[model samples]
Target chain A: MEKSSVLTVLSALAHDTRLDVFRLLVRAGPEGMTAGSLAATLDIRSNTLSNNLVILSAAGLVRSAREGRAIRYFARMEQMRDLLGFLMEDCCGGQPELCQPVLDQITCPC
Target chain B: MEKSSVLTVLSALAHDTRLDVFRLLVRAGPEGMTAGSLAATLDIRSNTLSNNLVILSAAGLVRSAREGRAIRYFARMEQMRDLLGFLMEDCCGGQPELCQPVLDQITCPC
Candidate 1:
């Protein structure tokens, strides 16, 4: 992925509220969450949540789908994987072991 | 890890020079590189690199040690691990599968 694109993703998640939103959506799995539900869960104003979601969407970190009358947002795992690949590639070219610790910690049973 | 700390690290890496510095240090391994060497490699000025290094250091993304008159910087993999752990915990509680694709891609032979 492009460095600018990676930067955008990083910047998008740098905020406290957006990071919370992204994690919550990730945990929500493919079911996602409607804007109203997300606002209620995070206890933020709809305008604040909307602003963050727009930034997240612009960064390709989150995507939304319309179901009935509400739009639900889902985390874009592919973009995150791409971000990790870009960072890992930096070390893999020289010392793949440099990323061994990080890769090990991120390994999940599921 | 604290959400604020995570945000700090993410913000530190959101910049072009700082991210370059961190990734280069990661690839450089424990030996790391001096500010001058890093500046030369990235083709930026000493002051620019120094400013970025300060932020990375403050964010616990990198550490510096004096070597003679110069100092070398190393990427703090532990902090990266913590960041990953915090993010993983987000999904592990509800859907560990959310992070599976990312983990699968990052799995290395080493």
Candidate 2:
């Protein structure tokens, strides 16, 4: 990803509410969750949730699909992956050992 | 890492100049680069570099140590690891396969 894209993703996630929302959506899985559910679960106002979702969508971190009368939002795992890749792009500078621990931490044992 | 720390780190890196500076520091590795050199290399004014460095330092993303009359800044790899771990903490939610691609991209082949 380009620097500007990375910046956008980072800025989008920098907020406490947005990060929590993104994590919640990630845990919710492919089926995703509705704005109402997210607002209730996060104990946030609808307008606040709406604003955060807009920022996340704009950054490509979240996507919405209209399902019935509700819009379901799913975490865009690919975008998260891209942001992580950009963050670590210059890591270790060809020395794998330097960043091995970081890699180890990110990898799921399961 | 706490949510606040992640926010701080994310906000610190959200800017183009700061991200560029951090990446430069990362590539410079443990030995680090002096403030004077960073200013020259990034073509940023000393005040601007100083402000950016302060933000990076406050976020614990970079560390500076006095070297002669100058300060040399180095990327804090451990902190970067913490930030990445926090980001991926909820990823895949026990379904490692879902996040395997992200892991693959971040791991250095070298």
Candidate 3:
């Protein structure tokens, strides 16, 4: 990923609301959740949620699909990988010991 | 890590100069690099670099030590793990396939 795109993803996740939104979506799994459900779960106003959803979608952290009358959002796991890869690229300059611990722990319990 | 600290780290890295500095330090490995060398490497002014370093340090992304007349900075690899862990905690809701690809790829080529 490009630097600007990395920055955009970082900026999008840097916020309290958007971060909550993305994480919640990630936990929600592949079926995902609707904007209404997200706002209610996070307890934020709809317009506020709407604004953050737009920002997250633009940053490529969240993807949405039309379902019936509402739109559902899912975490873009690939973008998450891209962001992590961008940061970890060239990491430690051949010193695997410095970062291998991170890799070992990265395998989630789930 | 707490959400606030996560936000701080995300915000600190969201900038161009600081991201460059941290990645350079990461590539530089445990020996790290001096602010002067970093400024020359990234081609930014000393004060500007100073400002970003302060921010990165405050965010717990970078650590510094006094080396005679110069201060050297190292990327806090553990903090990187903390940030990544926070994001991946409860990730996929028991769906390993959703995040395992990232884990497999996370092992640095080095």
Candidate 4:
């Protein structure tokens, strides 16, 4: 990913509310959650949730699909992967072992 | 890492200049770079670099040590690891395969 893209994703997630929303959506998985449910679960105003979702969508961190009268939002896992890859691109200066701990932490055991 | 620390790190890196400086310091490794050299290399003003470094240090993304008359700064790899871990904590929710691609990319094969 380019620097600007990384910057956008970082900025989108830098906020407390957005980060919580993203994590909630990540846990919700591809099935996603309706914006109304998300707003209720997060205890955020509809307008505030709408604004955060817009920022996240613009950053390619989230995607929305219209289902019935509701809009369901899914966390874009690929984008998160790309951002992580960009951050670790030059890590350890070609010495992968130096980053083993990081690898261990991010590698899901389940 | 806590949400606040992650926010601080993200906010610190959201900027173009600070991101460049962080990536540069990451590539520079533990040997680090002097403030003067970092300023010249990035073509940034001393005060600007100083301010950025202070922000980075406060966010625990960078560490500085007095070397002679210069303060050499190194990227705090552990903190980066923690931040990445925090972001990926709920990824795939018990389905590692869903996040395998993310793992492969960040694994750092040398």
The candidates score, on chain A by TM-score, as follows: 0.84, 0.84, 0.85, 0.85
**Candidate 1 RMSD to the real structure:** 3.6
RMSD of each: 3.6, 3.8, 3.5, 3.6
TM-score for candidate 2, residues paired by index:
0.86
Q: Per-residue CA lDDT of candidate 4, range A29-102, in tens? A: 76889999999998989999999999999999999999999999988877886787778766765564666555
Best model number under DockQ:
3
Candidate numbers sorted by DockQ from highest down: 3, 4, 1, 2
Over the stretch B1-110, how does candidate 4's per-residue lDDT look in tens digits? Answer: 88999999999999999999999888887678899999999999999999999999999999999989999998887787678777876676556566655544443322
**Alpha-carbon TM-score of each model against the true structure:** 0.85, 0.86, 0.87, 0.87
lDDT of each: 0.81, 0.82, 0.84, 0.83
Tell me each candidate's i-RMS in Å.
5.3, 5.5, 5.0, 5.2
* Per-residue error (Å), model 3, residue A50: 1.0
Per-residue C-alpha lDDT of model 2 across residues B10-99, encoded as one tens digit per residue:
999999999999998877776788999999999999999999999999999999999899999988877776687677765655465666
Per-residue lDDT of candidate 1, residues A1-110 (tens digit):
99999999999999999999999987886678899899999999999999999999999988999888988998886777667667666563486566656544444432
**Would you list the rank order by lDDT, best first?**
3, 4, 2, 1
Tell me the TM-score of candidate 2's A chain: 0.84
Name the docking class for model 4. acceptable
lDDT of 2 at B77: 71
Q: Candidate 2's residue-wise lDDT over A3-97, tens digit each?
A: 88899999999899999999888877776899999999999999999999999999999999988998999888778766776677656654656
* 10 residues in a row with least lDDT, candidate 4 chain B: B101-110
Steric overlap count per candidate = 0, 0, 0, 0
Which candidate, 1 or 4, would have the higher DockQ against the true structure?
Answer: 4
